[model samples]
Target chain A: MKVVVTGGTGMIGRKLIDSLLAMPELIDRDGNMAEVTAITAFDVVAPNPPLPDDPRLTIVTGEISDAEAVEALIDDDTDTVFHLAAVVSAQAEEDFDLGMRVNLDGTRITLERCRALGHVPRVVYASSVAAFGGNMPDVINDTVTPNPQTTYGVTKVIGEYLIDDYSRKGFIDGRALRLPTIVVRPGRPNKAASTWASSILREPLAGHSAICPVKEESKMWMLSPRRVVESFRHAQVLDAVAWGPHRVVNLPGVTGSVTESLQALSRAGGNSARARVTFEHDPFIQEIVDGWANTFETARGLEMGFKSDTGLDEIVNVFLEDDLPGQHVYYD
Target chain B: MKVVVTGGTGMIGRKLIDSLLAMPELIDRDGNMAEVTAITAFDVVAPNPPLPDDPRLTIVTGEISDAEAVEALIDDDTDTVFHLAAVVSAQAEEDFDLGMRVNLDGTRITLERCRALGHVPRVVYASSVAAFGGNMPDVINDTVTPNPQTTYGVTKVIGEYLIDDYSRKGFIDGRALRLPTIVVRPGRPNKAASTWASSILREPLAGHSAICPVKEESKMWMLSPRRVVESFRHAQVLDAVAWGPHRVVNLPGVTGSVTESLQALSRAGGNSARARVTFEHDPFIQEIVDGWANTFETARGLEMGFKSDTGLDEIVNVFLEDDLPGQHVYYD
Candidate 1:
C-alpha cells in the first residue's frame, strides 16, 4: 500500500521515511502478505529528495496546507497517512497569524479531506509533549489533565480534538502520538524550542561547545529517531478496540535533567567530547524548560504495549553511532 | 463605573445586565460606588436592549466582534468587562470559521487590547459545562480535566487558556465560569441543544406536548437563568488568588434525567401543569442528548462557595417562580 507523509522534508518526517524505506515487511497481517505500492512525501520548500527509485515509491513536493495539493496526495491505494506538518514552537510564538493559518487551519483541511473520503484510512498524527505544559507533576500520565500554556500546545490540542472527533464518527482510524524530544536529532536544526537538545550534542561532536539554555536541574523527555519511527509504525496496526476511544496517548520516553544529560555525555565522551560541552544559562529558556515539563507517567502507553527508551545512555549512543561513526565511546 | 458587556444581547447577558442595573451592588468596593454610571452592551444585531432608563445606564449598540465597535463602546470610566461573546453550540457546530473568530480570536483581541492599555480589569467570562465533555465520569469535579467533545468546547478550551495566560501576565483578572444549561429560559426559543430542558416545560405550559430527545435514562447537568447570573456576578469579585493558577472552574448544578425533569414537572403541575408534559422519542435528538451530560462534584467551586439548583422539586419551583412568576406549587 502507498503511504503518504505530510511535512515529509522536516526532521522527524525525513528520518521516519528512511525507517519506513528500510522496512521490507510493512504490513504484518495474519495469513496474508501485503506488498508496498508507493511512498509519497511533500513539504513547502520542494526538495529533490533522495527517495527510492523503485515503482513502489512516489514523491510529491508541495505545501500540505494547499487544499489542491492534499486532495491530489491521497489516492485509492493510500491506506496510511502520517501528518507531521506544523510550525514549531519558537516560530509559532513569534508569528501568531502564520501559526494559526498553518498549524490550526492546515490540520483542519487535512482532517476535512480525510473525512470527506468515503473510506477510512489509518492516520498517525505527530502530537507533542508540548500538548502539555504549565507546572507538571513529576511524572505526567495519560490520566493527568494537560493545561497547555502556549499557542503551539493549543493548536496541537485542537488538532487532537479534531482527530478524536473524526475517529468517533468512523471517518478514520486516527492515532495521535505525543512525542518527546528526539535526542541526537539529525540534520540542520531549526528555531524550535527543543532544538537545544540537538544543539548541545551536535555542536560538541562538530568540535564546538554549545550554549546550554535553562538550568541544570531543568528536565526534558526524549526518544531516539529509531524509536520515534517504531512508534509511528506501531500506531498504524494497533488494535483499535484495545485502544478503545482513547485516540490520543502520551508516548513513552526517557525523562532526564540537564545534569543527568551532561553526566551521560561525559561518560560517553572522552576528554575532547567533555571539553566541547559547556554551560550558559538563559532566563527565557529556563522559564520555558521549567514551565514545559518532560517527566510523565506514561502508564497508558506502557499498558498498551508501547515500549520506551532505555535511558540517556542509549539516546546519546544513537547519535554517536549515526553522526560520529568513527569515534569510540567509553560507555559503549 | 461603566461596565462593558461584550455579549450583552444574549439571554444570560440580559439577565446579568438586569441584575447589575437593579442591584448596583457589584461596584460596592469603596472607591467604586455600587451604582451604575453607564451600560455599554454589544451584539451582531442592533442591541435591542430593554432600554434601561435608570438615568445612569447608557447602551452603545454594535457588534462586539468588531474591534472598532468594541473600542467605541468602551469609555475611560469603564473598569469592568463581562466578556460573554460567543456563537453557541448549534451555530458553532455548523460553522467552524465563525466559532474560531468569535470565541477564540475575539477573546485574544480583547485581552490584547487590555494588555496594551495596561488596564487589568475585572473581566468575568462566560464559559460552559460543555468545556467539560468527553470520557468524563459521573460527578465531575472542577479539578477533573476538561476533555471537550465539540467545536464549541474547543474554542472555550482555548479561550480559558488565553484568559489564564493574560491573568498570569498581570494583563487581566480573568475569571472563567463554566455555566450549566440555564433552564426556564425567557423570551424567544433558541436553537441551543440544551433548549429542550426549557422547551419541554415551557411548551407544556402553553398546553402543548414536546418530544423528548434521547432516552429518559440519560442524565445531564442544568441550572436556571438566575443561577447563571449569580455565578457570573460571583466570578466578578472572587479572590483572584483563591481562583489560583486555574481561572476556569465548573459551576455547580443539578444532576438528573429527562424523566426526572418530566416527573418534576408533573408533580409540580398538580394535574394542570401535568397535562402539558409529554414525551415522544426522536432518534436524532436522542443521539445528541445521549452525548449531553449533567453532573459535577465541583468540590473546588463548593469550597469557593458556588452552588447549583438542587432537587427537581426545588429546580422546577425556581423555574416556575422566576420565569412563570404567577405559577407556584408546594410539591409534597
Candidate 2:
C-alpha cells in the first residue's frame, strides 16, 4: 500500500505521519488491511524537526497549486491521499488572492490529479468548523447547512463539495472531516484567530506567558491534537458504505470556554501556570471568534465511531504527553 | 451604464437582452437608474433567430473559460454582469472536464476580471434548484442547505460560495438565485434532464410532438421564462443591504407535476395539442428528476419581492405571449 500526505510538514500533518509510521497498516484499495509499503510526505517545505528515519518514508516539497508538481507528487501507484495544505483563516482574509490561489486552486489541482490517476484512490481532506458562521443556530448539528463567512471557510466548504462530486463520479473515494479548533497545538502563535486557544495552554505549560484575546465566557468548539490525528486514521479505514452518499462529516469535538481551559491548565501545572495567562481583549479577533458556532451535535460522526477528547483536561494531558518534552521553552 | 451578459445567446439570455433593449435602463453602480449605454452579449455561439437590430446590443462569441477573452469582454466601463453561462446537468455529467472548465473556471475568470477593474460591479448569477438534492426535506425552506448531487450542481454551489466571498470582500456586489427548472423554454430540447418540463408545453404549442419522459405524478420546481427574467432584473437592482450578509437565495417558484403541466397545455392549445404529448418512461431521467427537491418555501425571496409565475397557466401563457409567434415549427 502507498500513501501520500499533503501539508505533511504542519503540526497535525506531522503527527498524523508519525501515527501512520508507528502503525504501518491501513485498509488498502481492495478493502483489506495491508502493510504500508511506502509513504510520501509532500508539502511546500520539508519537515523541520525531521520525520522518523524509516526506509519506506520519502519527503518531497512543491507548490500544491502547480499542476505539474502535484502530478509528480501523486503518481499512478498512489493508493491514498491526505490533503491538508491550506492558507489559514486570518491569512486567507488578509490576502484574498493568495487564499484563492493556494486553498481553492490547490485543492482542485490535487483532486484533478487524483481523478487523472483513475484508480479511485481514498482522499482524506481537512475541512474546519470555520465551515459554520453568520446567523447560525445555538448548536450546530449534522443537518445545519454551512454558510461560511470567511474566505478560508468558503474554500473549505467548496473543497467538501468537490470531494463529494468527485466521489459521486467514482473519480476518487473521498472523505472530508470538518475539524473543530485544535486545542494545545504545539507551536508559537501564527495567523489563526483561534491560536490563543492553544497558546493559553501550551505557552503556560512550557513556562511562558500567553495573552487571552476573548472573554472567559467565549466558548470554542475544540478537539485535542492526539484525537484529531486518530480521526484521520479512523476516517481512512472506514468503508465507503459506512460514509453513505455524503462524503463529509462534522467530527465530534468538546466545547471549552477560556475559564474552563484555564482550569485544565491549573490541573496540569498548578496555580502558577494558570496565573501566567492574562486577558487583553482584541475586538477584531473577538468578533471573528464570536461568529463561529461553538457547540455542535455530531451524531453522524459519533455513529461512525470518530471520537473527541473527554474534556479540557484530556486535551491538556495530550499536549503534556506528546509535545511538552520537546518544547523549546521547557522549565521545571 | 454598460452591461455584460455571458451565455447571452441562449434562450433566457436572448430574452433578457430583448427586455434590456426594450427598457434601455438599469440601476447603475452609483445606486441610480441609468440609461442602458452598451449591452455586450457574450456566448459560445451567435443567436439563431437573430437578436434585435438595436445598436446597444453587440454579440461576441468565445470560450467563457478563456481568461484573456473574458478580460476583453468585461471592460472597466462595465457596470453590471449577468453571469448565466454554464453546462447543464446531463451534459456536465457526461463530460466532467468540460463542466469543470466552462462552469467552474469560467465563473472564476469572470469574477476575477470584475475585481481587477477595481470598481465593484453588481453581478447576478443563475444558479439552479439542482443546488438542492440528495436527502432533503419534503418542502425545502429558506434555511435548507444545498447538497447538490451532480457535477453541474456542485459547480453552481461552488460558484455561490465564490460570489459570497467576493461580495464580502467588496470585490463585487454579487447575488445568486437558485432558480427552479424553467418550463416552456422556447426552441428545441437540450441535454438537461428537466427539458421535458418545457417540451410538454413548448413542442405541442408549436404543433410538434413532445415526449414526456417521466410519469404524470412526477413534480418539478418550475418558473416561467418571463418571471425568471423579471427576477434577474429585481436581483440586479436591489440594494446590497436588502441581501444582508448571505448573497444567495432560492428564488420563489411553483411546484407543478406533469399532470398540471399537461392541463395548462390543454387549456392553451386544447386537447388536441395536449394529445401531441406521449409518455416514454426513461428510468435514467426519472432517477435524476426524483433526486431533486420539487417543493420550496422561498419566504426570503418572496419577502425581497421576487415573484413566481401565478401557476402553470401563467407559465404556458408566457410561452404563448412571448415566444409562440416566432416558433420554428409553427403549423397552427
Candidate 3:
C-alpha cells in the first residue's frame, strides 16, 4: 500500500513516518495485511534533521494549497493520506487570511485531489480540542457542539465537516481525530498558545529555565507524542464499519493541572528541574487557555481502542526515551 | 441606509424586500432611525412577478459565485446585506461542485465583499436547521454541535463559521440565523427534501392536489415568511454588543406533525383543501425529514427578541394575508 503524509516535516509527522517504516506491513481496506510499497512525506518544507535514507521512502516539498501540486502528490496509487498541515492557534488568529488559505483551502485542495483519484483513500485528518470552546459544560462529552473561539479552531472544525461530507459521498474514507494538546514536545516552542504547556516540561528537562504563563490550578488535556503517532496508524487500520457514518472522534487523553505536571516533572528530572520553572502570568495567554475545554468524556475514542498516556510521568518518560535519548539535565 | 438582498427573487427574499420597502425608516448602527434610501434585490433570475418599480429599488441579475459580479452588486454605499442565496438540499446533494461553488464559495465572496467595504456593514446570513443532524438529542439547543448529514447542511454550517469569524475580526457585524423549514410557501415546490412541508399546505390552498411523502406523525420545525423577514431586519438593527463574540443563533419556531399541519389547513381552506392532500410515502424524503431536528431550545434567539409563529394556523394565516391577499381557497 502506498501512503502520503501532508505536514510530513512536523514533529508528529516525522515520528509517525518512523513508526510506519518500522512496521512490516500495513492493513488494507479489505482488512488484509499488505506489504507497504512506498511512502511519500509531502510538506511545505523539507524535513529537518532529515528523514532516513530508505528505498521505499520519498520526500516531496511544495505548497499544500496548490491544487496541481496536491494532485501530483496524491495520485491514484495512494491508498491512505494523513493530512496534518495547519497553522497553529495564535498564528492563525494573528493572520486570518493565511489561516483560511493554508488551513481551510489547503484541506479542501487535499480532499478534492483524493476525490479525483476515484479510489476512496483512507484520510486521517488531524483536528484539535480547539474545536470546542465558548459556553461548554464543565466536562465536555461526545455530544457537545463545537463553538470554536479561534480562527484555527474554526478552520479545523470546517475541515472535519468537509471530511465527513466527502466520506458520506463515497469520495473518500475519512477519519478526523480531534487531538488533545501534545505534551513534552522535543523542540522549541512555536506560536501556539498551548506551547507553554510543553515549554514548562520540555525546557526544564533540557536544563533550560521556562516561564509558566498561567496559574498552578490551570489544567490542560494532553496526549503523548508516541501515543499520537500510534493513533495515526490505528485510525488507518480500523475498518470503515468501525467509524460508521460519523468520521470525527475526540481522542482520549490524560488531564493534568499545571501543579500536577510540575510534580510529575520533578519525579523524572528532580526538584531542581521543577525549580527551573517560574510563574509569570500572561493574561492574554491565560484567557485563551481558560477558553479551552480541559475535561473531556471521550468514551467514543476509548471504546474505539485509541490509547492515552497513563499520566504526565509516562508522557515525560516517552519523550526522554524517544526524543532526548540518553541526555540528562544537570542540577545547580 | 442602502441594503443588498441576494437571492432577492426567492420566496423569503421577495417578502423581506417588500417588508423593508414598507418601513418609513430603518434603525442604524447607533439605534437611531435612518431614512430608507436605497435597496438592491440581487439574484440569478429576475423576479417572476417582477418587483415593483420603486425609485429606491434596483434589481440586478447575475451569478452569486462570480466575485466580480458580487463586488459590483455590493459597493461601499451598501450598509446592510441579506445573504439568502443558496443551492437547495437535494440539488446540492446531486451536484456537489455546484453546491460548493454557490453555497460555500458564494457566501465567502459575499463576506469578503462586505469586508472590503471597511465600514463594517451589517450582514444577515440565512443558515438552516439543516445545520443540525446526525446523532442528536430529542430536543436540540444552542449548544448542540452541528453535525450536518448532507452537503447543503455542511455548507450552511461552514457559512455560519465564516460569518462568526468575520464578525470577530470586526470586518462585518454579521448575524447568522438557523432558519426552520418555511411553511405555506407561495411558489412551486423546489428540490428541498422539506418541500412537502409547504407543498402539503400550499398546493392544496392554491386549489391543486399535493403529495404527502412522509407519515402524518413526521414533525417539522417551521416558521412563516413574514416572521423570517422580520428576523432579518431585527438581526440588522440589534447592537453588535448584544451578540458578543458568537454571532450565530437558532431562530425560535413552532413544531408540528404532518397531521397537525393538515388540521390547520382544514381550518383555513376547509376539509375540501385537506382532502386534496394525499399520502404517498417516499422513503428517500422520509429519511431526510427523519434526520432533521424538529425540537429546539432557542433561548438566545428568544432573548434577542426573534419571534416564531404561534402555531401552524398562524403560519397558514400569514401566507393567506401576505401572499394570497384577496385570493381565497376554493372549497369543493
Q: Considering every candidate listed, which one attains the maximal TM-score?
A: 2
lDDT by residue for model 2 (A74-174), tens: 99888999999998888898999899889999999999999999889999999998899999999999999999989999999999999999999999999
Instruction: Give one digit per residue, the lDDT tens place, for model 3 in A2-105.
Output: 98999998988988888888983767655687977899999888987789888889999998999989989998888889999888787899998999999999
**In candidate 3, which residue pairs clash?**
A145-B145
Docking class of 2: high
Ten-residue stretch with the least lDDT total in model 3 chain A: A323-332
- The alpha-carbon lDDT assigned to residue A150 of candidate 1 equals 65
TM-score of chain B of 1: 0.91
Relative to the unseen true structure, what is the C-alpha lDDT of residue B203 in candidate 3, on a scale of 0 to 100? 81
For each candidate in the order shown, give its overall lDDT on alpha carbons.
Answer: 0.74, 0.92, 0.90
Better of 1 and 2 by TM-score: 2
Give the per-residue lDDT digits (tens) of candidate 1, residues B139-162. 677556667777787778777876
Better of 1 and 3 by TM-score: 3
TM-score of each: 0.79, 0.97, 0.96
TM-score of chain B of each: 0.91, 0.97, 0.95
Best by lDDT: 2
